[model samples]
Target: MSFRLTTRGLTIAAIFLTVVVVGIGVALAATSTPQFCGTCKSHVPYIDEYKKSAHRDVNCEQCHSKPGPFFFLTAKLEALQQPIAQITGDYEKPILGYVLNQSCRRCHNNDLLFHPVSKNGIRVQHRHLIEAGFLCMRCHSTQAHGDAVPPGSRTYPSMDQCLICHNNQFKDPQGQVATSRCDLCHTKPNYGAVPLTHKQNDWATRHGAVGILSTCSACHVKKGACSDCHKGILMPHPAAWISEHGVIVGKRGGNKACDQCHDTKEYCKTCHQVKMPHPAGFVDSHPAVTAQKGSDTCFNCHVVANCQACHDLHAAGDPRAHKLLGGANSSLQSTPTPISSPIAGGG
Candidate 1:
């Protein structure tokens, strides 16, 4: 059936279409509210946190959605799954969400970029940070959500987070290094105030285990601060230090420095098997000492060639030397006796 459109029929159809479009727009605006977002069980705690945040006056869609209209419409369409997931009880446990940098810049604008702001006790210059490609959410993730999330997932800015980039190694495109100095970021930093971690009884020895070593470097800026306590050794010993440490101690003349951190009397003696560097008269007394403890103890520091080199000086006429050396030529013999056996004053 072919029907021609009359003026009355066309006018009615246009009004009906306009009303439907306006109604859809009204529904979209209504559902974008925090109150509507809170209707979902997963978003209740987050909405409560948002209401108490500094951004309490800001709408949910302002930070949660991107800046432009196209992104805002896409975000709304993506949120269609929230009702379905809520009903089915299959949503993610912590319901992760992200705010784009563009959304943050929309409200913060270029004014924040060039100006330095004093917040709490921090002096923040957003110009360098934003230009360096850091996302606003990197340090301010909890600006809206607060601590509504779980422990490990909490995104509040911390000294640890600041140290990640503010460490002296990170450089800008212009080759200026990021300053790790506390005064650079902290407005009124009390350098004399000891951190609570330093108050622990065992902190002197155990602080290295608590956090990254670079975090300590942030405040203890002096080059000698670590070496002074570490006695010139690396704060955490290098991987091959065990095998090469004796040479290092030899060059330093003694283990007097090692005694600062280690209980060398008990600890070093366990490995050395004798008083290290020997007692004052060890050269003359070692024969008797070796008789008691065995030559295996001497081998910890000395080899068989060392004994041969010294014993060869004994004279054939000296009976005491002859008895100790088992004859002057005995030291020259190619087949050497075990230093532990009775052949060389051991017994």
Candidate 2:
């Protein structure tokens, strides 16, 4: 009535069990490799780029797989759908996947997160962000992988993302407000380590006008930064620039660039009084010139009110003073004198 197994039967069962175990072990090992993942054409470029990454030595599954043995197996099973979706053309282009924070914390361990390193009224600290439960991947999109991203896609974290939390509004757990200040998260920009924007053509001249000096000061200790090279003057102008700037402005036809640093009208009034860039002898010569050349030359620097008020011709109804120097149209007829020396030598 009892069941019995012969020697041949036991041997066959043992051989079959060994083969199944070996097959499963080989399959698991193969699937864990970056090579097997790259078999999907969509992943080929990612794998190639990852080979050059800081994480080149780490297995793909290490950062990709969920923690725990049970979840690890579950992740492997879930991954099978990737190749199937790739074949069926149902996968999203620029293939999207989230890397969990636990996977990152497995290596980054929070001990070194709050190391304070300050430079010029700025400090870098991440303990607050971590305590707030922010994911490391939130700020470091491609920290290890660099640009190992899909074609035409950005793999790095955007400045906009940093600004969202680091802006002037949001307060932290300690009731301290967040800041968009650059030095809070970055060290000083060194000799060759200056940002790419600073290195671009004409950045030195254009940066102030662009109104991003605060952003620059984040990494640059901007106190005396410009004056260091500019010799105490942030703007580029010669010693006699005050006396000569008018001709330079006139030649350019407009004062758009001048507006970057100076309120051109009010600034001119500071030194020129009724007559701007006109020299000491210009007052005497201007009358003769306006008589010969017309008052439009005066209008280049002086407002119509300047002429009317100065000449005691500001009547309520008519600007009769203009008639004495001839009407506005008279300038077209009168020939302009060629001065040997210009005001500022045409900026």
Candidate with maximal TM-score:
1
Q: Give TM-scores for every candidate, taking all chains together and pairing residue i with residue i.
A: 0.60, 0.46
lDDT of 2 by residue, 275-311 (tens): 4435689756876766654455455444555565666
The lDDT values for all models are: 0.72, 0.62
Q: Write the per-residue lDDT of candidate 1 for residues 210-310, one digit (tens) a residue.
A: 76677667677788888877767776666677577888888766878677666665556533666655789988888888667665555545545677576
lDDT of 2: 0.62
Provide the lDDT at 275 for model 2. Answer: 44
Error of 1 at 336 (Å): 45
Residue 8 lDDT in candidate 1: 93
The superposed Cα distance between candidate 2 and the true structure at residue 3, in angstroms, equals: 5.3
The number of residue pairs in model 2 that clash at the backbone is 4
